[model samples]
Target chain A: MFSYCSDPETLSGLTWLSCYLTTGKHTSLYLSFGTVLLLLAITAPIALVFGFGGASAARSRFVPLSWLGKAYIGIVRGVPDIAFFLFFVIALDQAFEYLRHTIKCPDWDQPIRQGNDFVVCAAAKLPLGDAPQWVHETYGFFLAVLTFSIIFGAFAANVLYGAMQAVPRAQVETAEAYGMTHRQAFWRIMVPQMWVYALPGLSNLWMVLIKATPLLFLLGVEDIVYWARELGGTKTPKFTDYPHGDWRMWYFGALLVFYLLFTKVSEVVLGRIMRRLTHGQATMGGEAQRKAAA
Target chain B: MSCWDTVADYALRSVGIGERLLPRSDFTLCQQVTLIGSGMIWNIYFGTIALLSGFFLATALAMAKAAHSPLLRKPAEWFIFVFRGSPLFIQFFFAYFLFLSLKNVFPVFSPLTSAWAGALVVLFFNTSAYSAEIFYGAMQSIPKGDIEAADAYGMSGWPRFRRIIWPTMLRLAWPAYTNEAIFLFHATALVFFSGFPATQQMGDALYYANYFADKTFNPFIPYPILACYFILLTLTVIKLFGIVNQRLNRHLPQLQRGRIRLRPMLVR
Candidate 1:
């Protein structure tokens, strides 16, 4: 990382610290913050889409579709979400392989689940047995994004469902009176109006999503938690130039502070957005604003 | 072995009571159910202790936050903010390492490094912060008329708080507090998976579920069983809270009393 980094034992104090911080592992640790951000970036919109579908389906005229939507929204209510995280990673992987196994190895004789092992044909394996390291990493990231989207989508669905209902019957009726179809009213009238109501819940979900990023380590992604543990463990002088005792507490403390600051900034920004959205609206917030101005 | 015998041998396995070793080879439905149910003991233990103890701290903190004096309020406000702001997983890891270091200086702190004491402390703080916020909101929303009425009757300080303020706050906060209890219980699953090592293979439901998933390579069964146990636990929390809620709101007419609606705030 630096020209001074070539010399090992002679370095001490800040010089040694500077070189150590610039190491490849530490660089990866720094980049892992981007991994967390990337995850949030990709998952948020997808979760919203999933939530929209679920909310709409729940409100559908068809009984079975409504039941399906309600179940999707209600599932996370009872079960711990970490269980879902663990289950879906394996379950989705297996489902993919099983589907591929039937198509790719049509004539293969042995059962897929032989006792305990799920033995898929090599051709059916996700990312392929011979794929590059990056491919495997990307595949895992993709699955994680899907899982987070699914769980958070349920929460968002609950919020959106409520928000949709809170959009006032008269507003939708006015759209119908103007000769708009039900679907048109839903899109043109209801959806636009629901955001103000949904903002609070959606902001909360965002914070939860931010906090849940550490669970990425459990999902087998080499995220910040993994790096913190790896780099912060006892490092003897024999191992490297920058030797230190167990510093995991400091590392985790830094992670904690990082999350705190991120959430604080998000709260401030979201508060501004909420204020902007509430202005000129008919809700309690707008009413208060009106009273204040007068 | 019959299901009854399996239950006898493994029913209390999670607490390190009956079984010395878990079933390895032929994983029967009976073994999964019994062992997993055994593990629920830990979940219930962590959840109950944390919720009960957290309630008192939360109540005190809520009052402190609502107090006009900065001397009483600032520390309480910061404590709640720090605990509420960070992820509980990071909190567990940070606390474990902190306890480990503290144990080296004070041997009495050794117990705090274990999951039973250490993880429990983290959960205690975490739930306290959340529940305190709920309580504070409820305190703020307490009708001014009620306090004024108490003042008119010459009620001041302690008597007014005990008879007029506290009960109403509890009634107002009950539904949200119930949600917090369920969230705290679900959070108990993260104990073993975090920094605290599960001693002697004894762990909560998710630990055994993870074991089965690892061995069987079939997640379809064990995870759902774990979820079912949690669902039952959730329902039990709701029911108990509902009873208390009914009692608190008993003074109100049936039409005016607020029903406990379960809005699952999925994560803390």
Candidate 2:
């Protein structure tokens, strides 16, 4: 990256360190931080959408729909989420391939599962098996996002369901008294009122989501955890310009600090957002604020 | 193999007792259930021991954080911040490496490299920090009148705390502390995934479940079994904590006693 890095072997001390930090692997490591952020940015809203759908279904008048939604929400509570992360990525991949295999290869007579292997025709493979490297990476990232959405969606559903109930029955009845239908009452009144109650739970869910991002490594994504272990391993002088003993502690320590700051910032921001959301609500927080202003 | 035989062979498999090798090919439902259930032994060990030992430390840390002296309070505050602030995954990795580094300088620290000693220590501290924060919150919420009553009786420091403060704190914090226990049990699954190597193919429930999923290329079965085991374990923790919660709150009038509800905690 620099002219001084032209001869890395001759460099020493600060120069050696600067050149080493600019290596290709280190660049990948730096970019992976963006991957973690992009994941949080993308997954949050999508999970919220899923949560809304699940909560709505669970509250639906129809028995089967409510049962399905309730099951979706309840099943996740019993298990470790890492199991879901490990399970869904592979399961979803196979489900997609199986669908593609049936559609794209109508004449193929082979069973998709031959004992232990999930066999698909060449054309049925995700990214077509011969696609560019970016396609594979994108596919992995997509799987990671979907898995996170599904798991966290259940948690969000639990929170939002509770929040929905917390909204006062009198408020919804007042909307009905004003000649609004049930659906209208829900959209115009309940949804707006529920956010104040949901904010605390949702903020906690956000922190859990941030911490769980590290498990992206288990899903085979070359995330920050992957890179920390990779870049921080011992590199002998015989192979590279800079020789270092095992520095995994330093790399992981940096990651710890990064997460600490991220969560700290998130706590502050979420606290402010909670205050703002509660400003005009018919709750204890809002009541206290009003009294203070008076 | 018969289901009974499979259970006998694999019942203690996680501890390397009966089975030398795990089932390989042509996986059966019986094998999946037995092996995954076997892995629950490790989970139970990690959770129970961590909770038992962490209880005392958590109480002390909570008291320290609530103490008037900055000398006692500052260290407790920072310990809670650092542990609660970072991901446990990073904590396990950092601890494993730190133990490895220490093992080089002092041979006495060598056992800390193994998952049994090292991972247990990490889980103990991690749960202690979480429980300490819960206890601290409960301590702060202890009724002002209760403390005043104790003071009127000439109770000071240790006696007051033992007779008046600690029992009330435990009663208030029981629900949250129960959630922490459940989370800690689930967190045990990450032990093998972290730096601690599962020696001799012996591993926890998720470990065996992952092994089957890899060998069979089927995650649908093994993971559900793991979920079932955990749900049962979670229910058991709730029940045990409820028993203790009853004893603590028994002094109250029957109508005023708070029931133990399993509050869902959002932790990975």
Candidate 3:
């Protein structure tokens, strides 16, 4: 922040606005955008990995493994995902703390749940009771990422499973005829080819995933929605240099435009990717490309 | 309290009709089930009413998007884009605040500030946009031959659409619209979580489930109970839609009747 920020009351118009925007809280608000992007960056790959595993397990010859995968994939279909989010954040936290409590405080003779409170040993607390603020924040964020990955993983599994099935049987058979093992054929033929089929679903999931980031506020993260509400409320000039009356609509309006632009960009990029993936392939898209070229 | 007594007291609790204070300690399974089931009334109210009203708006919007006039098409396109592109969570916040702002401007908008009116309006618009896009896609894919056949018979405009195009569009769009309905039901759980205060503890299933979770310090029970209720609600929606779908395609041959497949796609 500028030295001019020291006497913000004297400044008016753009000068006051500039200083206000540079405040520590606003900086945090700006950084939270990075947090949203980081979450998307981290969760997408992790969810894809989870999806791949789930899809494979669903297709496994082992009945129990297949059942596990089927249940994992089907669970999200039944429950509202926000319910899963709220449930998992608390449930996973308690589960972790409970595990740590059993391990770390084996001799402590106290019921963990005592009349509406989950009382864990101090040491068993996630990020510990003495841990720094950032540690707790990071721990909460990590849990959120995990929850997002788990829920979105099921959706991605649905997409990938369908994509894997869409791969022609003959392609895998040809890989087998070339003396490749089942695993090798799967890796070479099925996995590589499924992307083209999965792109549409995956892109849609990406858009949904983007939209769901605002729910991070519900998960108790200091994300954009939290900041928008906090900073956009009526603040008197007595308390602050630059006071504003209920500007939450403007803040949320900005967020709306941001999301709209993001989705538009994503659509363009996904379209290009789809075209690239389809080129010189056996699908109708590729055939059309070939026809156009001829 | 006895289970029967508890049920009698809290059966309609979510709508402010029954018990004033929820059960504190000694939370029984019966209490959880009965209370959560009571809360489900709001979910059913929001979902069915929103979907029923949104269906008509969505049909009109879909036709507008598919219309030849740019004026109609552009607004329709933007309406879908604005609603579809943003998170419903934020939409709820934005709408609640907007309604509050309007209440200051005019006393007539005061009732719209409440969750029952405000949140329902958001859900209505949200579902309308989603369902419109689905219908628009279906409209685009309506077989050219059918339209050509209608043209050959001199059927045009409203008559052509009413007799031929609309039914086929509905048939084609039914499966996707079913998915949208399910998502809308799920999205209704978000109403209370947003800016809307669940006045007098009259909240939806998630709200009660959240209350139980907060009270018990154990999320394992209440969330699943809510999920079970929702799963049943989802199945019921599918069943009801399936009947309507059957009716929509009654004139078609059995083989050609589009089978309703439940694909749980994106949530708002």
Candidate 4:
């Protein structure tokens, strides 16, 4: 990255450290932080959309729909969420290919799940068999994000459903008296007011999402955890320029610091959002804000 | 081998009382069910032990947080802050490495790396901090009416607290405590993924399921079975917690009650 980095051996102390940090793998590792942030950026809105749908479904008049939504919310409570993360990555991959196989290769006849192998035709493979390595990695990441959004959306749905119910009935009734339909009353009155109630839960969810970014490694996306493990493994002369005995402990330590710092920053930002959202609202937090403002 | 024989030979595999070698080939549905269910025993053991121990520690920490003395409060506050602030994944990694390093400094603590000790210690402190935060919230929110009633009756100091404060805190905190228990149970799955090796392949559900996934290259079967076990376990948790919640709220009238709600928690 710098002209002085031409001879890594010639560099020593700070210069050596600078040149070492500028390596190709190091660049990828640095870029991967952007990947984590990008994941948070992409997944949040999508999860919210899923959560909204789920929350609405949970309150639907129909029995089955409510049951489905309730089941979705209840699913994550038991067992472990990591189990879901591990399971869904594979399950969703196969489901995608199975759908593609049915549509893309009508002539294929062999069972997809025969014995142990999920043998979808090459034509139906996600990212395509002929695609580049980046496509494959991005495809894996996309799936991970989708899986994460789905699982978390269910939990968010539970929170949002409660928040929606917390909206005062009189406000919705007042909107109705203004000649608005149920849908409009919902969109204009309940939805607008529900934010204050949901803010606490949503902020909590945001932290969970931030913490979840490290699990991308388990999904095989080569996030910070992957790079930490890779760069810090027991390096020897045969593998690369730098030789070091198992530095995983140090590498992971740095990663821990990175995560803690990120979480602390998130806490600060979300705390601001809570203060903003709660002002002039009816909850205890809003009352506190009102007094503070006075 | 017949399914019956497979069941007899490997049903208790996770507890190390059954077949030494896991089924490598000709894996059947029954084998997956039996082995994974066996693994649930470990998950329950970790969750139950950690939760029971964490309950007392959490109460103490919560009390310390509410105490007048900084000497009592500072350590408890920092403990809650650090544990609640970090991811359980990193906690697992940090704890394992820290334990491993400790072994170098003192060989007597070598067993700290085992699944039983290592995983339990991590879960204990992790759940303690989480429950401590919950208990603190409950302690703060303890109704003024109840305290006033206690004072009116001339109940003071330890008697006042033992009679009026403790029950109210537990009642208020029960719902959140249930959620913490569920999370702690889920967090047990990280044991195998962390530095602690599941000795003799005596691993949790995920470990066994992942092993099968690696061997079969087909995640369809084993993982879902693991999921089923977890889903069922979660339902049982809800049911159990619900029963306790009912007992906690028994003094109150039905109309003035709640369903014992839970909020989503981050980190562990």
Top model by DockQ, which number? 1
> lDDT scores for all predictions?
0.94, 0.91, 0.92, 0.84
Instruction: Find the candidate with the highest lDDT and give its number.
Output: 1
Q: Taking the candidates in order, what DockQ does each have? A: 0.84, 0.75, 0.80, 0.56
What's the C-alpha lDDT at position B24 in model 4?
Answer: 76
Which tens-of-lDDT digit does each residue in A1-294 have in candidate 1?
889889857888898889989998999999999999999999999999999999999998899999999999999998999999999999998999999999999999998889989999999999899999999999999999999999999999999999999999999999999999989999999999899999999999999999999999999999999999999999998887778999999999999999999999999999999998999898899999999999
The candidate maximizing TM-score is 1
List pairs with backbone clashes in candidate 2: none
Model 3, B15-42: lDDT tens digits are 8887799888889989999999998998
Classify candidate 4 by CAPRI docking class: medium
- Candidate 2 scores a chain A TM-score of 0.97
- Candidate 4's C-alpha runs over 4 A off are A1-22, A62-67, B148-157, B246-259, B262-267
lDDT string, candidate 2, B51-85, tens digits: 99999999999999999999999999999888888
Model 3 agreement with the true structure over A1-294: per-residue lDDT tens digits = 998889887889898889989998899889999999999999999999999999999998899999999998899986799999999999999999999999999999988889778999998989888899999999999999999999999999999999999988999999999999989988888998898899889999999999999999989999999999999999997987678899888888888888889889998998999898889998899999999999
Report iRMS (Å) of candidate 4. Answer: 2.1
Judge candidate 2 against the unseen true structure and give its global Cα lDDT, from 0 to 1.
0.91
Candidate 4, residues A66-137, lDDT tens digits: the string is: 999888776666557788888889889988998999999999988877776779889999979889998999
Interface C-alpha RMSD per candidate, 1 decimal: 0.8, 1.1, 1.0, 2.1
Q: Indicate the docking level reached by candidate 3.
A: medium
**lDDT rank, highest first?**
1, 3, 2, 4
The model with the greater DockQ, 3 or 4, is: 3
